[model samples]
Structure formats: structure tokens, C-alpha cells
Target: QLDDDLVSALKGALSGSLEALILGLMKSTAQYDASELKASMKGLGTDEETLIEIVCSRNNEELAEIKRVYRDMFKKDLEKDVAGDTSGNFAKLLLALVQTRRDEPSNVVDYEKIDEDARALYEAGVKRKGTDVVTWIEIMSQRSVPHLQKVFERYKSYSPYDMKESIRKEVKGDLEKSFLTLVECFENRQLYFASRLNEAMKSKGAKEKVVTRIIVSRCEVDLIKIRTEFKKHFKRSLYQTITEHTKGDYQKALLSLCGGDD
Candidate 1:
């Protein structure tokens, strides 16, 4: 076990991106997520991207734990914080996610319901003059991932645009981004993380916080898959990308956490 005093000492000794990475790595996953949520909502403005990514991507059990940890650590309700920080349809979608109401992944896929949902999504967005944000939120939030996958697949037949394109046409701003993130996560979560990592590294200087959060958060879960997807999609390994984008202890730490090349 990592000693709390020792961790505090290390935190005191270290600074900058390296310290952030190291400290983030040391927290329990739920604790890390809770802290990230708090940080996103801190101070002048909310980091809505972080809020969307964390809230929309996590499964029910994980979100439940994160919400609990958020209250315990910050003495603030995660739902209230989210609701307070956001408004309109975006807030509604995020609050729904925070409720942790998503159905679990299961082998059993209901094709009948899946088709119905696909049609519903089509009518709500592509088929209608105005977007039905309520239907979009309900289906996206409450349905199982497997069910959603099939629904998105079936949705292609009903509408000229796929689910993502439909979202783009239907909404704008944070809501659009959040829905897109949710769909991407449902489609291929590892690929979603890989894309996030790539986006972080695409510019001249790395977005170190985003890089650290995804690498550290998903390290134990699905990083190997993320590495493979990164290589396949971006034509460069995550290991190499990190090497090119970062240096010193921060680089070394990320490389080690990356495990190895694809």
C-alpha cells in the first residue's frame, strides 16, 4: 500500500506536469474521477469537455462510485455541481448521466427494441423539422451499450446520416459534443480514448492534463486496446507519440504507464 504520509511527501517534493501525473496515478480510480469532476467545475468557468467525457463515458457502477466519492471528498453533490455548472438540454443530458441510470452491457440484445429505438432516433432528429432532444437523451442514457450499438447500426438504414451526423445536424455547442462523445464511447471506447490522446498531442505543445488523465485513468482498464487503436487509426504508436510530445520525467512516467508499444 502507498503510505499517505509518503504520498504527501512526494507531492510536496514534486511539481508541474510530473507531479500531476504522479499524484493522479496514486489515487483510486473513483477518487481520481471525483477529483477530476471537482477540478472541471472549479473557479471561473467549468471545463465542460471534461465533465462530458467523464460523465458520459463511465458505466453505471463506476458513475455511482464516482458520485459517492465526489460527495465524500468535496462535500458537494456531483449531480448538483453538474446541474449548477450547465444549463438547457446539455444540463439535462449530463444530469441524466450522473444519475447512473444506464443499463448494463449484456449478451442478450433485443433486436425488436433496437429497431424501434433506431426509428425513434431517426424521427426525433433527421426525420423531424425540429430536434427532439428529450428522445435523444432518453435512449442514449437509459439503453445498454450493446443495444445502442445495434440501434445505431439500424439507424443507418432509416436515415441518410448516421447517428453522429444526425447529432451534428440536430444540436450545437456542448450538447453536440457530449452526445458525440457518448456515441463514440459506445461504439469503441478504446478508439475514443485513442482519439482523445491523439487530439491532445496533435498541437505543438501537448495538452498534458488531458494526456495524463486518459493514460492514467484507462491504464489498468483498456490502454492496450487504446494503443492498438491509436496505431491503426493515427498510423503512429502511442508510445512513440508520447516520446515525441513530452520529455523528462513526465515522458518517462507516461511511457512506463503506456506499458509498451503495440
Candidate 2:
């Protein structure tokens, strides 16, 4: 940590240039996410799905930073805002996710535990008449990614269909969508992004916001893999798809981030 003298000196230096100070503050990814989250909640209709997706997908470290950033930027608690805006089981799930308490990814995998969870999932959803959403939520939310990977792999053997297809058949509404997204992302984030990009492009009028968000968010992380997945799954390059679907400065900016295809 900086000493008080250095801190004061740095603050004084930054205070002299308003533009520089603003730019420096805007450079933080956590702050950017916090700002976006706040904006999503500000409108006449809340972007509830986006809020849930972001909170659920982010791991403990990222969510902790997000909470700090949210407080710094909004002078309000993220959890409280979420609670005020949402209700019922969905709200509870989002609240649980924002706690940032997912089990850390584990290298060691227990085959028996995986089998048990897989069986539990099958019994909770498909094997019975009514679905056990609480069981599904608890299992999906609490498990490590590695463990979930194994659980999904083992689930196929226990069930007639793949996990995604099973989820499609067994679950419905927002919970279903969230679980499917989580399963897809845990299996392959790049492919999930490619699918999102494809959906954005294929829809009527195009989903520019989704496309921009994915490209900007993943450009530094795995845009190359996303491009590859786009090609592999869709039989067309992400660049070509973006070129066809978007126009003007937005298209150019997204293309620059997309770079080249596989």
C-alpha cells in the first residue's frame, strides 16, 4: 500500500488533469462491469436476465471485485439492488450467486460423487413427474466446474439423452434458461459465445447489443476460440457473419475485435 504522503501526492497530480483522471478511473474492468450492471437496472424495465447471467457466470474472485466496484461506483449495495428489483426463487438464486461462494475448481474428481449427483439430477427432474428445482439450483450453483463437467459426462450414461436435451425436456421458464446457459458455458465458453453470436445475427433486425457485448467482453479473453467455434458450428467465419449482419462504425469496431478466423 502507498504511504499517506505518496497517496496525497498522486491524488494531487491526478486532480490537475480532469480528462486524465476520468480516463484512468474508466480503465478498470471491474468498474466497467459495475457501471454496466447499474445501467441495466436503471431503465423503466429491468434487464433481469442480463443481471442474472452476469452474476451467475462470474466466479468468486470476479464477483468480489464487482461488489467492491459496485459500491464505489453506485454508493449502494449490489445485493440490495438485486433484491429490490427481483422476487421469488429467481431473486434467491441471484442473491446466492452474488455472494460469490462457488466451490473453487478442483483438480481431483471423484467418480462416485459424480455418479451420485448425476443420479440425483435424473431423479429430481426426469425420473419423477414434478421437477425438484431447488435440488437442481443447489447442485448447479454450488458445484465446482470440474465436478460439473464430470457430472454431466456421467449423466449421459445414466439418462437416455444428453444433459442439454434433458434440460430442455424437463425444465421450463427462466430457471431452465439459466441452467442451460450454465451447462453450456461450463462445457465450452467459446462455443457458448459462438452460439450467442449466431443467435444475435440470425434473429430479425439483429441483436446488436448482444453482439457488441460478447465481442467487447471476450476480445481479450477468447475471441479466437469463439471465432473458431463459430466456423466449426456454423460453417461460416464470425467476421463474415458480422460483416453481413451489422453496418457502419459498430460493424467496423466489432470486426476489429474479431480479428481473423481459424
TM-score per model over all chains = 0.95, 0.83
User: What are the runs in model 1 whose C-alpha is more than 4 Å off?
Assistant: 1-4
Model 1 Cα lDDT, one tens digit per residue, 13-65 = 99999998899988888999899989999988999888888998888888999
lDDT measured at residue 122 in model 2 versus the true structure, 0 to 100:
89
Q: What pairs collide in candidate 1?
A: none
Give the per-residue lDDT of model 2 (tens digit) for 51-140. 755676666777899999899878999999888877766776777778776788877778888999999988888889987878777788
What C-alpha lDDT does candidate 2 achieve relative to the native structure? 0.76
How big is the positional error of residue 129 in model 1, measured in Å on the Cα after superposition?
1.5
* Whole-model lDDT per candidate: 0.91, 0.76
Highest TM-score: which candidate? 1
Pairs of residues clashing in candidate 2: none
Tell me the lDDT of model 2 at 58. Answer: 62
Q: How far in Å is the alpha carbon of 105 misplaced in model 2?
A: 2.1
Over 4 Å off in model 2, which ranges?
Answer: 1-27
